[model samples]
Target: MNYMKNKRVTRKKEKHIKILYIIPSKTPTGPHIAILNMAIGISKNLKMKIFIITPKSFELNYKNYYEKLRESASIYEVSFKKQGILYWLSLAIKAFKLALSKHIDIIHTASLKILIPLGVICKLIPAKLILSLEGNPLYEMFEFSLFNRMIIILNWVIGMRLVDLILPCSKWLKSEMAQYPFLQDKLSFLHNPIDFERFQNAKPRGIRQEIGVPEKAPMILTVGRLHPVKDIETFLKAAEKTVKHHKNAWFVIVGDGPLRKNLENITKQLKISKHVVFTGFRHDVERFMAAADIYVMTSVYEPFGLVVAEAMAAGKPVIVTNVGGMPEIVGDAGLTVDARDVDALAEAMLKLLKDEELRRKLGEKARERIEKSFSAESVGERLVQIYGSLLKDERQ
Candidate 1:
């Protein structure tokens, strides 16, 4: 089938398949980065073509991220006025036109908002639909009225079943999707890819020094949005308890969100303001990861924690709340605790901080886990195998 396959003439003619990645983020996020890594892997390993479609406006601001992406895949920009409704409609029309006019193998998309429309479009065409999930949007529906929740759930029940495959970043998330019996056959584990070597060779930017902490201070780092779901408050509470047991351990929360001020105030209320620091949304996240003693994730509902893997790749022991995919990612490699439990979080954090040998052993395992499972080279093989199988199945 034909979409946009990177073509190179080899002595043995290899089949080239076109895979179009639909990314909805105006800026780069976990899903967007994963697609780029997968595209690079596909291009390098399988001699296939990859295409990335994103909003035109945001692409202009983030040209640095897109430039390297062009080497592996072709980039397409569409109008995204009013959050891309018009673009989706036009994308459907264009995709359908391509379905009849050209050969396109797969249309991969993430998020429930884009899933319904694009899934409908893929259903109208021969292209296979690959649904990539970062987190379940339905989980947030608890705040909605039952009627509204039921309406959305029914829509999801229908939409999810139409996809050719559902790709969750971890097996834990795959298990959650299995609740819908129809999704069982369609589900697969596609862990997010990380730049293992980049972290392996990174030079620490002294994030702690920049934040006024001593160079020797044991730094506990949490990198995520300052949102309710991220549960930074729990992290702060745990940090408050941690300092009592291990003084000179500085907690740095490196992200910005609606809850930033609230989290900051909580740090003040907890009276650990001197011990806790908030560095709002640094682009240099890996630098902070390189500088920290341990990484922490306190998400109440994480589908797959990317930063946890990155920290592991940086050879830092991680402390993650045992929710969703965190357990799957951190199993045997890092410490885990129950969600919203400050005592457990603090105890786990303290264990890593005090035990240098244990921390090093866990860190080594963390990097090995990422290298074996979450690296681009490893995941590229999975993508190539999956794409080849899908094509072969279609032929039969």
Candidate 2:
């Protein structure tokens, strides 16, 4: 108890601004990738300190990458296994101590699960909570029980109230999330930035060459998890019709998930197995996006189609479902069709496949848009500016 009280006083003696990034998952996800890139992007900042909070053993799989990040930032590993109440309570205590010492300027949490706990920490400590809504929060509770759903909903409402900053990745999300009165006042825009370095370095070696896809044939590409919300079944149904006219066209999916087996079975049933390839979760996603002739996104509820933007950065023309923030990303640069409409998706694919001139024009426009808005350097500077503003605002 004395330690907790003195921890606050000790933090007051520090002058350097610090940020504590809280990410609960040990998986390679959008928020994980975003925070990593953000860390690397702002590495040269000598004044502002950044620390990443991740699950234990995260460094085991990503040693070099984490080491590189640690050059500019510190890492605090916590055991987040759903073992027991005491285990989590202990972890929280440790995190609180760390934040107290660092005089944490910001506590950035990507989802609601992290938000609820860390949001409390923000109130307890001299920190500002930045809650980034990574996806549809309600959709995440779809499989939960009625009681569990209610609990999460309450937490979300309270968490939004606690947070100092609420960033939705796109303007569409900003508008969509306005349903909640608390979120409406706190909301700000911060589109997920693509790692421009990775996109540029995607490869001189095409993914087609690696996967044995014919160099002369058109490659239709999709890069996302084989999840239900992704609505990949419609893409396959569209492929069933699109492949009839363009037999040389091959569809490549570069992700893995629970629905992989189901998607494979659907491909076989559609009788387009010969025309489809699944490259189950490659680290080199940008390489595949660059190698492809065109990119497609068919999500029913994409908060922001980060992959679609990456594909655009890769200078590939894209076709995306007109839902959520997909249209905001694609804008006038790519083709858009109704979500789950197999006929519309197939027609859009066919149109892009046939028009070489149209494809090149759109691809050029897409790349330009990415460089201007979604580039790594731009995102890094903008994030740092936001951080600076938040800290400065509080001091005032």
Candidate 3:
């Protein structure tokens, strides 16, 4: 009986694949949220031992999400003053030790900043390193100074070669990275998962009453930072055209950035200021989504429109720019228009607002699509398949 019990214990331990996720962020950003959701999903769906390391302050800042995630994985908090070389080195050392102690099978991270350190550590360990590409590094490089751009390029050339797998968050990003022949062998695409429960349960927070808009007025909502890339100017212009037909329609832009003043000026110039409201940065974005009749994303370039999925999860019909991965996420559930096409955007918004039956059908389809494709369980299953293949190849 003792010998049989010992053999069963070993078999049970072998079935649990260990993965370590290093997310070096104090606040909940897009990459951080994506990692957390993926980790939770993997833990729930697979017999995996999951470990996560983040800045010590992350727990304090996002207590609710942290607690929920802790239930699914072993979370370790590490102190870091700034995201510099020393921080990355510290994270690498911590991860290396944990990987060795736990016999971690895979190490994953979304940030390029820590790629080099993690890559170096992976070379010395038995684990496979997976990099989750959340944005177009080549396109984003131009946003920085010349020296910083060079650093980013160097990181890509060196760090990418060290990674065992490169998982872009969208197929659009995978195609963009495919231009580099070296990345062809390692590249794959994975869509970001959404926290459907939160969005589905969110109660409307009476945003119309707070903003002095009529309760029954049709509300068109767009949630993203007011930046040039997001094309808020186009949204405001589209709103200008939209109000010409539906005077009772209201446009709400929820987010803040350096371009807020410029976008606000554009709203004034459009003479639709009365019909538009700019609510700078609100945490309760789900509540706003709940209150809105329609959702729109006018990004000039988007990697994977996570907010589009969020809006879809909220059961709101979306209008996304036909760029990057927005169309892929929207599929047949919502409308897609050319970026910066104010006329097309206005027409789509009008169509959704005017045809209640069409809006209802699209909204139902949007939620159904999200449940089927973008749910945590679905994403987790895809990830587990990838992990299994990678490990199987390693053994062979």
Instruction: Show how many residue pairs clash in every candidate, following the order shown.
Output: 3, 0, 0
State in Å the error of residue 111, model 2. 2.9
- Model 3, residue pairs in steric clash: none
Best candidate, lDDT: 3
lDDT of each: 0.78, 0.81, 0.86
Model 1 lDDT tens row, 169-215: 88888888788777789888788877677676677776667889899
Assess every candidate by TM-score: 0.88, 0.89, 0.93
Q: Is candidate 2 or candidate 3 better by lDDT?
A: 3
| Candidate 3 lDDT over residue span 1-396, tens digit each | 664455335434587788999888786778778877788668776578899988888777766568778777888878888877687678888998997677778899988877777888777665789988889788888878887787788888898889999999999999999999999999988899888877867778777798777899999999988878999898899899889999999999999999999888888889998999999988788889899999999999999999999999989999999999889999999999999999999999999999999998999999999989998878988999988888875543
Query: Model 1, residue 13: what's the lDDT?
Result: 50
Model 1 regions more than 4 Å off:
1-14, 57-65, 97-102, 141-157
Q: Which tens-of-lDDT digit does each residue in 1-396 have in candidate 2?
A: 776576556555666668777656666788766666666667677766888877786686555358668677888887756624554566567668888776777887675654567778877776888877766577678866786677678777776688888778888888878877767778887878777766755773766877879988999999998899899999999999999999899999989999999999999999999899999987778778778889999999888888998899988999999898889878899999999999999999999999999999999999988878887667778888888787675554
lDDT of 3: 0.86
Candidate 2 TM-score to native: 0.89
